[model samples]
Target: MSKPYFDPDFDNLLERINGPTCRVCIDNESMEDCTVVKVDSVNKQGLLLEVVQVLTELNLTISKSYISSDAGWFMDVFHVKDEHGNKLTDQKLINYIQQGIGTTRETPSSAKAKTYTNKVFRPERNGYTTIEMSGTDRPGLFSEISAALAYLHCNIVEAHAWSHNDRLACVAYITDQSADTPIDDPGRLADIEEHLTMVLRATTAPSTSGNQANQQEVKTAGFLQGSEDQGTMTNVERRLHQLMLSVRDFDGPSGPPNLPAVTPTGSEESDEEGRRTVVMIESCDEKGYSIVSIDCRDRPRLMFDTVCTLTDMQYVIFHASISSGGGYAFQEYFIRHLDGRALSTESEKERVIKCLEAAIERRVCEGVRVELCADNRAGLLSDITRVLRENGLTVVRADVATQGEKAVNALYVKDISGNEVDMEFVESMKREMGPIVLHVRNETNGRSSLPPRSSRFSLGDMLKSQIDRFNSLTAL
Candidate 1:
């Protein structure tokens, strides 16, 4: 019989060629529209996600990808570009990508070098305290959080807040106003935690189901507590997803906005024009794999959201083909449980579909996009959110960041009654906050414009060749 595709000897041979460090090769001359990134490394359980995370965090758009890692070695190729659809020509960015996914050195056996975990190396230029909070989500909840932080004299430098199914997860980096450094006082830290916990409890209505108390958690940590030489950091967005999952955010009535119902037999469903999200699952009895297919509107970080969900759900992806074109995304995965079993029961299949649907929906912001840029201050968030609450708008999603002296923020807001936001209100707010500082970007009610029915691309035409190539490489 022919040797298996992932034979041990094949991996040994790769180790000798690539050395002990991960190999990242970039080809800019090959693809005109995108940069081709090739990675070869020893196979690890979570290595796929580690590589994807680096790209996603950089705000790069992955146009196409082929993933294969079943044994001792992993090799993959990705076609990527910036949001503007240009090739990556920045030398600094290219070098960072190399260092982010591979070691600083080609061979690590002899030289003493600073090793990178997950290719993360954060320098200690600024000191800040990291605050993580999760609890019941409510309208105007962010305003309250920011108000409290401002009251504590903390300068909010960066924050990300996500809400799904009446749950909220927030991570904020702040510095003490007095010292411009992380708060290291034990007593002060306890006070901050206690105050935030109380605010969370007060905002949440009494849960008739008696599960409300289980959703609250507050953590405060100093970024300077650890050794400065170690450059380890957590992917905050991934952590937010985990926190939302931990609170059972997927159990809500919202599965995606326009996705149709899916049955246990993996019946495929789409909108009348087939523009909405389409999900289907099929089990390969002979190969012992459960195949998942997803087709939906393409957006930034689309693959990261799905892959992270599958990984967190304890499913291992043996093979996957991902590609996007004409503002639509196509993804297929051959996966199995960590215990090496395919999805057997009907309930198991249904749950997988629902969880994947929920994962997709969590990142789909549904409202008017409002961007705020101003000088950073302790009360900037507090003031901005307060005005939003008072203007009959509710923030559905928010991203707050600080660059040098500027506080740049993006917020998605809808009318309190869930109607389309009045542009008059938006203009009024822009004037109130200074027209030069605030701007209206995009208004997406969880839907993008679909191509005309006659010109719609079919799944078979988009994915068949890629799938065939993957199968050919893995065939014994």
Candidate 2:
């Protein structure tokens, strides 16, 4: 086989080998009604989500938490309680958690085979190149697409993606980095499409080479074997030292950096006008990264949306803090462009804030109506409708039709409360629904589902109630 594509700088192999390991200890002597769970682990991508997922699966509710990460190591302490608000005394459960987090798993390669369609490229009114892609969804699909764009040195200004039933669609506003202009050249546009298509079609499986595996094992053992330098500093101290070195590099001006001026928006301060989501972006001189702070009401999938938006825009998060209490979430992220520079213009900063604001607004608003066509199956309609309900959506009208094995579904839906569905919600629905359609199509030998027909209806009281609550919150 051809040598696998490898970039030491990009892959950060050493970092992966030394990825976070977890240790969980229960504090029996804590003076509280809840159990105290102490976790120490090496931090990596999706660390928070993993921890939260485990706790949630265990049916543990976190009453309070203290989370911090320095360099690659993180220490999190959570005050948790069982469903009855009692301290957890189950030894087996505690042991299960301890073992669950102690081992590291290899990160999966991004290359995967996916089907793409509705490929389109056009010039936006804002003098930016717009690229829209729709295709079958899989894990790491977004990363692969972003990687393709980065390879072409494209600067993404605005992006939105949605996935439903395993189908995914994304619309990105980007500009050519080298030219700093719209990608109007037909040749360049074709080249971009070709490269993106290749990425989408590529398939990669994990290496099975014993020798390569042994080499990785040896490297890991060496780290644990210890050295004289390891004796001089504790692990936490070493991590802090590494963090300091990284900060120094970030702060040092390697080029003529154009930094945005800092202006406080007073969004963080409390006012009698109720809770208003505040988004602020300012330059951090010490770290040479832009600190984006958001103070907003907490809700389901809030962090996912915010992080997704930033990731879609090609922002590299170096450090972040997320905390929520009293029905509000406070988040601060230290970030830089993928090229390691701060945003260069006022318009750029504004765009970043605007995107974040839009994300936040969409979380609370009614979503857009969606229409889907797929192969018919038993319980297919119920499955699709269930997904909508689970995602906090209310279907106001439905038109379902079945012609032979093919089915067409048109649903008018809004946020459980009646507000315009956000782009994020639309993309999420598409990602989820795409797979079901694909599976049904295959089972029927590529035949379409029978088209069944339904009728449209007026909004119900539940939707009205949601709208009232939303209005009340916004009024405050």
Q: Which candidate is the best by lDDT?
A: 1
Per-prediction CA RMSD (Å): 14.2, 21.6
Candidate 2: how many backbone clashes?
A: 50
Instruction: Give all candidates' CA lDDT scores.
Output: 0.69, 0.51
343-394 in candidate 2: lDDT tens per residue?
A: 7778788777866665454323222446666554333444455445655555
List where candidate 1 sits over 4 angstroms from the true fold. 1-21, 104-126, 203-207, 211-234, 253-275, 432-436, 445-476
lDDT per residue (tens digit) for residues 420-465 in model 1 = 6666545544544432277785555445433333332332222233
Residue-pair clashes per candidate: 0, 50
